[model samples]
Target: MSEISREILSVGDLNRAIASSLEERFDTVWVSGEISNFKAYDSGHWYFSLKDEEGQIRCVMFRGRNGQVGFMPQSGDLVEVAANLGFYVPRGDIQLTVQSMRRAGMGGLYEAFLKLKAKLAKEGLFDLQNKRPIPTHPRVIGIVTSPQAAALKDVLSTLARRAPHIPIVIYPTLVQGPDAPAGIISALKAAEKENAVDVLLLVRGGGSIEDLWAFNDEQLAYTIAQSPIPIVSGVGHETDVTIADFVADLRAPTPTGAAELAAPRRDQMLQELDAIMQALLQRVGQRVEREAQTLDQLALRLNHALPDPDRMREQISGWQKRLNQAWLVRVENWKRDQGYFQSQLEMLNPQRTLERGYAVILSKEEHAMHAVRNPKELNTKNAFEVRLAEGQVEVEFAKLGLLK
Candidate 1:
């Protein structure tokens, strides 16, 4: 055999050779173990030991790779890591540099789910204020899901049972696989554009987080939040919650539950209608009674205001009799006054006084002279006249005489 020429290798060279060999043998691997001695540095690097019942290996996740890990690794957490073997020359130790990690059974999809959830939550997408109120009784319930999905059947059955009269419009889309997210978003947009439905139900059957991964998409969650119509998410079983669940207006544990919440029961609505009808009837009856009572009161007032015909006639008769008596009394008093005035006139009449045997004497100037006491007072040469009641005579005063 030819003598093998050996070149001494430096520790750095040796470590590099081993690291290259390990990388070549296990460029990417899946390792399941419990985490131990985990430490996270301010630099965002993570160092831990992955231990099994048999043994444990040191691990390091650098800042870039660990940042993609949605959840922080804790000591004693059961996790699976996808990593490549690396050798440190200075320490002369072998360790794994993790590229990704997830909870054991969930796979890498779970990490993506968690990451998207945390991001949306931090941005306030999951806030209660952003959530809308589900319609109490949707006139039309819109469904966004694969037509072939069993969840669709479940929802339809539930809705029919609850609200048989409500109309339903289906906006069919893929509920799983890689194309599901885009399909879901398109369906949601289509439903909104139609503008017919009062509420939307985005539903899917129960499955692994991978099967429901489309619902966990950040864009899908945002679309649901920004939808003009209220959205009720029923993406999976009760225990499974997706990003869509947090951003939706309402969350239902199952597809059937979503249908139930979207509408009111027919029987219950009928009961309410009946109650309202009865109340309205009662109010109308009371109003009619009140109006009738008012009419009766008005009739009583009219009766009181009307005058009695018999009493009016009697009053008119009494007034006529009093008026006739007053007229007679006035006529009699006038006659009495006229008779008294006539008597006074007769007493003062000059012709009547002459008829009482009174004589009148006149002077020469044709003036009356009465009671001549001395005859000498008369002028003989003057003519004098004497008058009786019926005749007058003229004479001369021949002799003087005194008369009283």
Candidate 2:
């Protein structure tokens, strides 16, 4: 009680002590800020700093909890992060570890967009199974986009150059800003109602976050998921991604890519057709030549055979008579041999010694001769019956006693 002593700590120890104190005092919190200096690790962890106008804080988002954040936060993207104040124990540095996150737009509209996207993905509306395959040879390709958009020209020119035979039916609509969502949705509906094309190209030029908001609309995502015809989304540049990219059957990096993806290249298709045609022609020619060879062989044989037709007929008739006479002589010899065998068969008959279909009664023992008369060793009634080749008869002594 009289003396006071304090242990001098190094920077790490002091930082650990402060972090431990903060952890014990404060619970988890939610923060809103613009993301900057975001970097991901090879271990699939994200390290970033969240900054408001005045202050900034470091953050870490582990891969396991990363899904809680719907879309990736771009540099300078205003975001709402649900996090907890914690200490990085090894370094004893205080940091914000995030659990859930969402983009925070003006009035948090971007946050709402992320929430809706997460919900739709969980419902499997954006699954590959739901995506339709674009027709291999679409008779008509539909373009759902702003006619005024530069992307429209890119799409038309690409399709015209790639597949000149295929016609493009443009379904013009707004491609940016708030009203663009409804306009795009209605254009798709109109295309489906008319069954105007085999597949659709939903395209737009590159833009910033706010400018591309229409492409992230949940209703539009669902519409794409349910569209009967296949859709190829080519919104923004290759680096830009939208909700439509996941819902579409195919995602193109640019508007020109969408057009080229929706139809086949004319030169490649014609080359394939020509190859197949040549193969078919070769097969037909080979078959005709084979038939001609067979006809020639048959004609030569006919020429040789028809030269002495009368003599050939006479020779065939003579051979037929000789074959018949030889057959008659063989039949007579077979009849004579059959008669001799029949006589021998009649002489060996057991029935002839007794009567027609004869029967002989024997003792219970099969080897007992009929001439043996030891009745004491035999039972004639139920145990004994004589079987002939044709029939059987039971002899009754009315006794079943065994041989004594």
Candidate 3:
């Protein structure tokens, strides 16, 4: 008998080859089942078994992938997951590595959501420029919701508490069921026609996708886009999104949130107004102070420019004193000069010489007298006169000779 030839394989190598074959043979696939024995480890990895009536599969969803699921899955949750098939080397077990997950039967709703969101976005209905700004101080707030709904009560209470002074108008309508979309649109139209409210709130409570589907209606989206007044949509919880949220001017998480957004708190607004007034008063005071300082500077300049009466008087008095002193000096000088000239004149006078007993002889001829200066001019026959200081005497020049 001949020995048969066989290839030997290790456990690790077989498991690796099996894992590779499984991954390569099957493309990414989606499977639906009820979750069982779901466990979330400290490492944020989820280990669970997905089972149908007749079969079950082990699945693992890493933290990185499950974080995008938006909600945690419990053991009984009916979910669909997109996964890749693989064989675990250490345990030699078949397993699925999950990439994404969502609640079962939500596929159609999600698809519709995406389609509508894309359509509206493409038409510019969700543009920031097209959206209106929510009023910070609304005088009148309008609500569009079911009168019997619990969400209406929450909105009313919030508005009453925050802005009691603001008047509230209720446009009651259906917020659920098949006719809710049309009812909401009619209410919006009514609010527009009345034009009484400064801002409008479209509010509803949180619910499943089916329960909140009315808000995603195409006509409702169009109505919201065409509304003249600003609309705030609070259709569901924070995690829930709808077409109305995209088309409205603003979106809130809850009905109370919508009320809070539409109406400003009275106390908060009062505080803001008071602060503004204080700032304005401060600015006015500063400006007035600056003007006052400028005025004072101008006044100082003017004071310097104008003549001071007291100073001018002092200057004038000094000038007058100096002028008087100069006049007195000139007068004394003139008097002194006059006295000296008078003395000189007195010395030149012949009367003083005559008064000193000196006499002058004159010759008289043809009824005129002449001084006899030479002996030849005075003849013996001619009459002569002797002049003295007091009087003149008649005489004859009998012997006019020089006596040395």
Candidate 4:
């Protein structure tokens, strides 16, 4: 018999064959396990392992697939993955090409969130009537957020741009994790206790459902509902919503949105003020024009009724006394009318108020009109203009009180 011939395969060929065979047999599968050794590369690819007590498997999720996952994946998370069983020809290793993934036990948390939300709604805690209106111009804006969070920077920058003169007070707290709920509650309480800020802003950056779970706490929701100061919640991105968001007086899509809602734009306010001043000037001019026409008509009638000097020459002495009395009466009436108009103009002058010991507080940057009805409205760091009768004085109030 002739020698039997057999084919020998190289390492590359073997790996390729195995990879092709695995792809053909197990097209798709569902696997449940705990995630571990998770790493995300700059290329946007995610590499991790799905492991059980007995075994483990390597997984690869490319940028396109993982980008749609919504929430960020982290190690130690239990998840169910839908993927294709595949083999890596280069490493000669078996791996999973993940198509999608979801938290293994998220349904229960979502159920709890819905239940608490429904309960609160039934109790009218989320009623529109109960929601307080945010002040158009808050004297002091209070912020409850993590001091180290990027959201704080966004909020501060927005507030500075829109209304730099407004004072801000920050109550720092943890925005996530197991202790975040308590920290938030405590911060709200402290802001109320201080009674400093006119409005409260509760804000944080975007995160996964688990990362935002602190805001969904039952106690935290109740605390927000019961807060004395009106709360503006800018908890996450536009699409992300939480229990606190529903309970807040107003909901802003972003931290910057919250700032915008809390204060009016300085430029817009100035334009409105200018329009009002122009309207007043136009009305005053019209009134003066009308009054002058009436005075001219009265003078014409008086001239027509006067006796002619040449015709009354013989009785000049007799008529002189009557003319003198009539002239005196007319001159006195004109003086009284002039005095009344002058008083009216003086009353409308702002300088009159300043002369009467009242000063106007104007913001240095935005020039926002502010009345210092309460001492708390003053901030030592902010500059202000105090317009008096003689001249304006720029001053900063470090501390304010009645002098002993």
lDDT of each: 0.81, 0.78, 0.85, 0.84
Give the TM-scores of the predictions, in the order they appear: 0.47, 0.51, 0.68, 0.55
lDDT of 2 by residue, 36-146 (tens): 999878998999999987999899999999965546677798888788898887776679989888666533655676787799889997787777988898888888888
Kindly list the per-residue Cα lDDT of model 1 for residues 61-169, writing each as its tens digit.
9999987766677999999889888887789888988999978888667677778888888999989988888878777889888878899888988887887667677
Clashing pairs in 3: 363-370
Model 4 C-alpha lDDT per residue in residues 300-395, reported as the tens digit of each score: 565577677444443554455575576568657756765675576456446687899988777543322344555666788888888887898889
- What is the TM-score of candidate 1? 0.47
Q: Which tens-of-lDDT digit does each residue in 1-404 have in candidate 3?
A: 33455666899999999999999999999999999999999999999999999999999999999998877899999999999999999999999999999899889888999999999999999999999989887878889988778998899889879876676778888999999999999999999998989899999998878889999999999999999999999988888899999999999988888888888776786577557656865785676568657755655665677678566556556755775676568657756765675566455456777899998887656443335556678677877788898998887656657999
Query: After superposing candidate 3, which stretches have Cα over 4 Å from the reference?
Result: 1-7, 41-43, 147-150, 308-404
After superposing candidate 1, which stretches have Cα over 4 Å from the reference? 1-111, 282-404
Q: Model 2: runs farther than 4 Å from truth? A: 1-6, 20-29, 34-77, 82-93, 97-102, 105-133, 148-150, 189-196, 206-230, 236-254, 281-404
Clashes of each: 0, 0, 1, 0
Q: Return the candidate ranking by TM-score, descending.
A: 3, 4, 2, 1
Clashing pairs in 1: none
Question: Which number leads on TM-score?
Answer: 3
Best by lDDT: 3
Error of 2 at 151 (Å): 3.3
As a whole number from 0 to 100, the lDDT of residue 332 in candidate 1 is 72
